[model samples]
Target: MNRTTRLQQITVTLLSAGLLTLSGWGAAASPVQAAAASVAAPACGTGDHGLLQDLQKAHSGADSIPLSFSDVEFLNTNIGRAAGNGFLIGTSDGGCHFQKIYEGQWSFQQIDFPDNVHGWALAAVKDGQAKYLLRTADGGSTWTRLSNQAVTFERVEFLDSSQGFGYNRASTYYTKDGGESWSLIKTPANTRGAAFTSRSNGWAVVIVPGSGYRVMKTTDGGAAWKQVLKSSTSDPIYGQISANDSQVYALLYGDSGMSQTSYSLYGSSNSGGSWTRVIAQETAGGGPAPGSGAAVAKKGPASGTPGNMVLIGKTTAFLAGYQPAAEEVGVGLTKNNGRTWSNQKAVPGFEGVISFTDHNRGWLAARDLNSSTLYVTKDAGATWTARFSFETAGR
Candidate 1:
């Protein structure tokens, strides 16, 4: 009775039963791209096995095989979904074209899509120490492997299709039935990231072995949590957490020494109860630290912040970073939720992962280490365009 009032009574019962509309793509065509090109092939048979096989090969001529996507989700602007390395691609029309809805050898890292046809992934299993949890209703074609026990959760958040929340650094998992079953809550000792707006409301970013970061919260859900926010000392702070309904964001960074590295972004429109730093620390550099003999600090302007953030509504938010000496990519926008911040228009690559499905569509995944590229923006990040690319060892 408080998931935003049951999602505003399920969007007023889907606009009084008309099923709530508003979808476009020029000429008459696009029922979610004709139901995603009518199931873009997802039935790989080889005695299938766990992790939902399918997608044996063919990502484009020449055996396309170099992917490094860690995450990407666009339930709009022409269906979209992406996962890392081992594959789990999809696209109807928006990002040029993408296929292969599932594959394995292990590697999903993170993915969550609370709605638009349920989704959730976290796999890792490739001798990577095990971790699994994959699910997809109809949007990503096919995927099913709820849990075989090893749960590490690099990060995942959902608030629909039956609640969700998972974090890393050892534990923190919860599912309210949509994940088939999962529950190991009671987090706090180093939980790397977490974000939730309902299912009782939540937030996390702990890491205090010697005292460095904290930003816990919960409201009758994760059993119990408190520590509003911390980290004014202890030097090793690093953080992450993002939310939209009831707002809630946290970034945090550390190491502000001669080599720089001080970021901070905090906001909370109630879900977290109280918080407001927006963006403060703002520093960035990584050119000297191999020896501790720092020197070569003559860059005088263009500091940095926005390590990465996404919250396309609830006042709007979008932040990205990667300005290694202005090579490109450095946006840091905010509509009002963060008081003020503006400097859009600077896309290129290497922002890793970012997503937005509102305030004018968005997507970015510029991984590196061989290949991984995909960018798009309608006018929100000011500008950007580069649909797809994933090549390695075939180049």
Candidate 2:
């Protein structure tokens, strides 16, 4: 049998058994429909402090801060917005060129839209100085600063115009009046990430201190939570979760044994009720090859960091992470619901955020320490064309 067939067979067998152990070989806004299949499914991820530092450096020596996009959202084949490092830019003719919509000192770390007409942005000043929330109603063509509160959240997601969640590593807050004000929501301590399908359903990534990480679910908004998935003390879970309606995705990491660290992908079709091992234990040294059931890992890959995952629908998802096999950042695509995955184009970065409007077209914002590059793919994830590097956008 071919490697893909064999790996699919192994996945089915392991999934039927319950949890796929660390052995060998490794959101919200439902109310708003996607604008087009040729665009992305809104924005659904965040950057880390390292990214913020990169933004700070890029902001310091230039007359205009470059388009170091922390997050990107494409509403259609020809309309999109990219935000980061004191600026928000939009394009009316695909991504060929962009015009600035908003610029300031606070870097925009995340942006979310319930629909093409309603959106939100989360920003924080360099050096941990302050935080601000902004809103846009004309498809990001213009933005209005909503509030300049003491909000420490690094990410934001809106289920609709007036309901959304803003969370960080410490706590989560909910806003019902279009970012006007927020109320502290009691979540598990150290809630690192959160995503919601509606005003009433949500999931969170919580750190378990002495143990590991947890994937928790809540039916009544964020008032209560139940443990749906947990990691072992040795193989801790990463702090990023993405959910849309009843489908969810979470990450678990293997022990970083000095040389390399591995990761596994878990998927749930019924919210966070149960999970199946989509990708099995994949080590840095001796793991199976890409289409042979294991996702690749880099040597000494950052501990507690998992690859970025963006779900396109119920059956299609994209995985972006380090691919030591090729010594470049790689993209993996699964059309048969992770029964199999094909490693797609390799981009020039160690980390990336993927956005897909559907199975055919997508965009990737790939970043290294010195620059962030944008790429567009027309044939799903098979091939990519460099559109522009954010490091040189305004130069």
lDDT (C-alpha, whole model) for all candidates:
0.60, 0.60
Assess the local accuracy of residue 89 in candidate 1 as a C-alpha lDDT between 0 and 100: 68
For model 2, residues 1-395, the per-residue Cα lDDT tens digits are: 00000110001011232211111110112222212222332331222214334444656675654556677777556556677677766554456544455666667777776665678887677435577787886655566777645667777777667877787766777889988888877777667767666666777777665566678888897778999986544434345676776568775554554334565667777666666666554564433211222233222222223466667667776776664333466667677665665666576665666667777787887776567877788898778877656554435
Off by over 4 Å in 2: 1-67, 103-106, 125-129, 207-211, 235-238, 253-261, 280-307, 323-327, 368-371, 390-395
In model 1, the clashing pairs are 44-54
- TM-score, candidate 2, is 0.70
Q: Each candidate's TM vs. the true structure? A: 0.29, 0.70
- lDDT for each residue of candidate 1 in 175-269, tens digit (9 for 90 to 100): 78887877777766777776666666677788765556788888877788898877554554557777766678777665554434565567776
Best by TM-score: 2
Error of 2 at 307 (Å): 4.6
The residue ranges of model 1 lying beyond 4 angstroms of the native Cα positions read 1-73, 76-115, 118-156, 159-163, 166-173, 179-182, 186-233, 241-252, 255-261, 264-304, 307-395
